[model samples]
Target: MHEVKAKGILSAQNGMNIYKGCTHGCIYCDARSTCYQMDHAFEDIAVKVNAPELLEQALRRKRKKCMIGTGAMSDPYLHLEKELCLTRRCLEIIDEYGYGLAIQTKSDMLLRDLDIMKRINQKTKCVVQMTLTTFDERLCQILEPHVCTTSRRIEVLNILREEGIPTIVWMTPILPFINDTEENIRSILSACRKAEVYGIMTFGIGLTLRDGNRQYFYQKLDQHFSGMKERYIKTYGNAYQLPVPRGKELMKLVRQECSDAGIEWRTEKIFEYMHQFEDKEVGRQLTLFD
Candidate 1:
């Protein structure tokens, strides 16, 4: 882990990454793709020591409150977060400024900030987004090693639901000849149903592989799934998008299951919901005055 003073915190779209790179060791991580251009190793974890300060400044400058997003490129609750507390501090600032939060992570460590997130949710919106790729516990361990498994993530979702904090699941990067199966999709959707997630975001029924990430993914495949790398090379042949053969069928299943359960399956609608900010305290204040 390394610390660096960042020039700015929030993006033009209000998204911020408290840390750059990750330690989750997920075999299919796209953040490692060459297109991103990280100066150091992916696991080096560049910590933005000034993130909370910068975020506070940005929030104060906003004429109108809006949702502040994080964890798009790197998990804010990475292992270093436990001690650094940068993510926690940023969350407190967002809560203080009455801005909504849309945070994405696969770590159970997020539960540590439940109090702050609940406060933000009570005042405005706070949505927790988790990614669930493989349903089978063993496979999940192999695919997303070093992070919390799917079952634990599902439990976190259930806890969030009970707390009245909305949640979304990113059921993405379904690896071909690996986790791209109907059973995997159905099982994950079933868990989502039980957790009562607000939405499930999927980019079809397969994962993307580009230059940097593709090489890393293939290396892991050779180590874990013997001969899988050769198969991928033969099947994909340097393609960026590697959609599974049963993508259409599996996607149809996702749409049907999400529709039947009243969960949002449309990617655009889910993004819209996460970006839109709501102030529940305002409604309560009006009601009290009335």
Candidate 2:
């Protein structure tokens, strides 16, 4: 890991990535695509040494309070977080400023900051988003090798629910011919329902393959599923969005299940929920003015 001084922290849309690159060896990572143009190895992990300072300055300058998002390109609860505490410091800043937080992660290490997240939610809003790809524990290990398994993530969701903290599940990158089955989808949705997740973000029943990520995913396919790479090449040569044969059927099933469980599955609605900032004091003041 190397530290770099960042000129700025938050995005125009109020998102922040405290680190560049990732150590989680997920084979289907889209961030590996050459389109992103990273100069260093993906695992090298470029740390923004001044992220907390920058975030504090940005939040203080904001005229209106809004939700702050992080962990879009890299997980904030990486192993290094235990020692560095950059993510924790940033969370403190968000809490101090009384701004909402919408953080995402695949690791259970987020439990370390449970107190801070709970306090943030109690003051405003704090939504935790977790990505669940494969329901099968063994398959999950093979796919997301470096991160926590599916069951453990479910536990985290349950913990958040008990604390009255809303959670969202990102059910995506369904690898065709590997995990694009009805049972796998059903199992994941069942877990989400049991945990009382606010929503599930799913594009469809397949993953994307581009120049950089495609080659790496194919390599992993050869290593794990022997000859699966050839099948992918024969089926989807040079295609970017790879929709599985059962995509339509699987999508229909997901919609039906989410509807039955009362979980939000619409992409637009979920994005709107995460981006919209809700302030009770501001709402009361506006009501008085009107």
Candidate 3:
């Protein structure tokens, strides 16, 4: 890990990335895609040493409170986070300033910050978003090698539910020939149901493969799943969005399941939930009590 002084911490939309690059080597990580223009090697992990201070400044200057988001380009709780504590420090600031958070990650290390997350949620809102790609443990290991498997994430979700911390599940990047199966979708949604997640965000039964992401994904396929690269080339040569043959049917199933369980599947609604902030600006005016 190397430290970099960031010019700014929060995006115009209030999103933040305390670190650049990711060590959680999900074989198909879109962050590694060339479109993102990551300067260093994907594992080097550029740490924003000034993140906490910058966040405090940003939160303090704002006239109104809004949800502070992180873990979009990189997981905040990557192994480096154990020592850096940048994410932890920033959360503490958000808690102190009474801003909501919508933190995303695929790591179990997030459990370390549960107390602070609970504290923030009590004051404002703090939603934990975890991405679940596949349900099979062995397959999960292959797909998301650096992080804990799906079962553990499910455990985290259940724990969050019990803590009154809302959660969202990102069910996405469904590889066409490998994991795009009805059974895979059903099993994942079943686990989500048990976890009582507030919403499920899915982009259909398919994965996008652009110039940079497609090359890396295919390379991994060549290494792990022999002959898979050739199949992908033949099936989706130079295409961006490669929808599965059963995509339409599988998406129908997902909609029905989400409807039955009352788990949100509407894309716009989920985006609204994430960005829409509550003011709670209802405190009484100061009084000397004379």
- lDDT of the candidates, in the order given: 0.91, 0.90, 0.88
Top candidate (lDDT)? 1
| Model 2 segments more than 4 A misplaced | 281-290
Residues 1-290 of candidate 2 have per-residue lDDT tens digits of: 99999999998888999999988899899999999999999899999999999999999998877888999988998878989999999999999998888999999999999999988887778899999999999999999999999999999999999999999999988999999988999999999999999999998778898889998999999899989998998999889999988999999999999999999999989987887676755552111011
Clashing pairs in 3: none
The superposed Cα distance between candidate 2 and the true structure at residue 185, in angstroms, equals: 0.5
Backbone atom clashes (below 3 Å) for every candidate: 0, 0, 0
Clashing pairs in 2: none
- Misplaced by over 4 Å in model 1 are 283-290
Query: Model 3 over residues 157-273: C-alpha lDDT tens digits?
Result: 999999999999999888989889889999999999988898998876788877676777888898899999998889888888889999999999999999999999988788778
- In angstroms, give how far residue 99 of model 3 lies from its true place: 0.2
